[model samples]
Target: MHGGTVRPRRGWGGVPKINVYLPDDLAEGVRAAGLPVSAICQRALEASVRRVAAIRRTALSAHEDPTAGLNQFTDRARTAIRTAAGRSRAAGGQLGTADLLHGVLDEGANLGVRVLRALGLDPAALAAALPQRPQDPVGAASFTATASAALELAVTEALALGHDFVGCEHLVLGLLAEPDGSAGALLRDRGADLRPARQAVVAALVGLTRAAPDPLHPVLARLDRLERHTGLAP
Candidate 1:
């Protein structure tokens, strides 16, 4: 693939012209997230394309694909957020990250929540504890950068261990693995001990490998079982 100056391709009968104008705050967020504006746009577009491809692949699978049906939650979350934001704005309220997290919870993705439960972490709890936005203008960029880096490291760990997809377990592992991350520090401040949890995850992964199943499959399957055990429905 070319690194730069790649032209957009014509598709869907003809090339469609599109433009995205980032708000000043959002543009700052992109920069704070340690991504150039172009990189941010490219990744967002790529994810959308890959999601559609994943749906098509799911439709071709004979066995049940949990991810196939799970994607509706994104659209539902987005719609709920838009609706809530509209109402809030009508009432002269400003929308923020708390509103977004609430929207995600409102979509009721049990599978997602289950994974969090498996790690003894709750998104709702984290959402409540997290600052919706940084109060200090000077630290806003650094705060987001730290969060982004933690997320990236967590994802990288999963992939490096031969995992095929990311789930809530990865998020937990990421937080626990990153001693210097904001989320990790917060968890520590709340008296959560990650050392034991990390050892347990490592042991479980080793045991899973000894069972002779596809390594990635077991990781994902174990995660699913953990979800069900926690009473989260797919």
Candidate 2:
């Protein structure tokens, strides 16, 4: 199935050229399927660039505080916030919780994305439900108050779950806690209730705890407590 060698396109405007490496079986399958491997690789690369840019944006936005502990946000969560910020900036709209939800889906691989997929919710569809705005006359993007509140709640969720790092799963909990946020409303309308989402989060964390034991000890303990409290423990 594999015949021609995959070539790299020349970089333009200071963009570096990248060589793609594919396994024999996968490369053969791509050739057999007549897929546009170069285009697919380009798109994936662009998405990765966007995600990295968003992470940088998120890190820069946070103020350095000596008194307060430094926030430990997973790459996935940072990317989600960055994606939300990018969407708001593009539309000249303030970043909101809904944008954050869209960002989580946009990131593709994360706890929130997995939970939503399990519920048969399409990330693209969730994104479509967000309000679209025309480009602003003077471009400026800021976080809405509600969005800020949700972020704080995300931190709180992480603490409650006994996690040292904030992640996309905590963001989902934040969305669910935000009473008036569009993200929560949209998810609820689509049958993603808070309880089920929490359950999924716990279950996933439990699996992770078993798969990788040391880093997740506190999280596993918290989950055990929660499960017992809810009478869901075996």
Candidate 3:
């Protein structure tokens, strides 16, 4: 009745809502952009919090905090991206988001890739979808190796669906896309419903509203940093 209350709404998840305030100019910006003010505010706040937490996570290795570990993941990932981009430039090719993703996947030191492997993804399968790297007359550097067709398709799906980056959820969707692929077969074998799973991820990505303080809310902010760090999005 006053500010937006967490009324049990009708939907797949019965999501909750929170009330907030915005300045006149901010409200105008939201209106001119044809956006939901509450959602925009929530997203910005979430992103900021995540960025701080992620940086902190990387700075302090001794702390066993979950936030610490998550930030470390991003830190390691950014480092790998920079290294791969250097390789690509050395070979004369411009680095791109796909290139960065390939770098992340190839970085044997990171636990993110390991987590994907544990979830039944065969890294080799991704290789099959890789696009031919740009070749300079002088043989510009090779940046990202080709991903599997399934992996490419997954990335394509995320882009087509208007997502800025291919996160873990997108990877899961990609795995599901490959029915005959290793990850797909594994998920299916385990009785995982790909459609529902995808929907759930989408819901989390879209409808799951959050306030500034939640731990997981920072995922978007961390993603923004990743985008800039990897040269994924300007």
Candidate 4:
């Protein structure tokens, strides 16, 4: 029962015991340093378990629905729009491009957020730039003409990209394509140009399509470099 002899719990069933192998020199150094090997290993395992669970949650959220039609939008994209509509309704204003912008950021893991981060813009700051909506309007909130046009353009962007599902990236491009939209204006004011953002989205799609077996691999290594170049990432 000495302090150094304490070991982590073994499995309840027939599971095998886990072991760690270290280089002789490293093992000797650790022993000489009087490190608590079991405690260190336990902490490392706990951190790894948390990381894996987060990845699983993200993957589940991004999973494509099998029942969706060929031309139907991805669940994430649809969720973003629904979130936007809800925001508009709460504000007593019609759904507009600005609401859509907020929705994409709210969705969290979509390509639209990646594009904004790639371009060195804080999504939260961009969201804060949207104009305040009036309260207690007379009628139900609906999509504005510009917002409707943006949705149609999103479909067109998806088709052009040869993707079966419309996504947040397409929605972002659609916002930029719209001639008169507050969301697009806000993006431009934050230095998010259409051409570069479009290029980044295309590159990101390519990387995702060609990603290797490891889920944590840097699919956007080039984009990461670009972000670093722009002082977005360290």
Model 3, C-alpha of 165: deviation from truth (Å):
16
Candidate 2 stretches with Cα past 4 Å from truth are 1-70, 132-138, 214-218
In the range 1-234, model 1's lDDT, one tens digit per residue, is: 113334566656895534465546545655577867655556655654554344334221123222343242244433433432432333343433333333344444533334444556676786687544332222111113343344354455454334444444444555656666555666566555654444344445545555656745666575554434333325
Candidate with top lDDT is 2
What ranking of all candidate models by lDDT puts the best one first? Answer: 2, 4, 3, 1
Models 1 onward score TM values of 0.35, 0.63, 0.32, 0.57
Better of 3 and 4 by lDDT: 4
Which runs in model 3 stand beyond 4 Å of their true positions? Answer: 1-73, 132-234
- The residue-level lDDT of candidate 3 at 1 comes to 16
lDDT of 3 by residue, 58-171 (tens): 321122222233331245545544444543554566444445445556665554355445555555555444444443333333312222443354454454344544445554
Largest TM-score belongs to which candidate? 2
Better of 3 and 4 by TM-score: 4
Candidate order by TM-score, decreasing, is 2, 4, 1, 3
As a whole number from 0 to 100, the lDDT of residue 128 in candidate 1 is 80
At residue 65, what lDDT does model 4 achieve?
Answer: 27
Q: Find the 10 residues in a row with the least total lDDT in model 3.
A: 59-68
lDDT of 2 at 72: 67
lDDT of 2 by residue, 90-148 (tens): 78668888888988888988988877776667888887888874543335577777877
Model 2 TM-score is 0.63
Q: What is the C-alpha lDDT of each candidate?
A: 0.45, 0.71, 0.47, 0.67
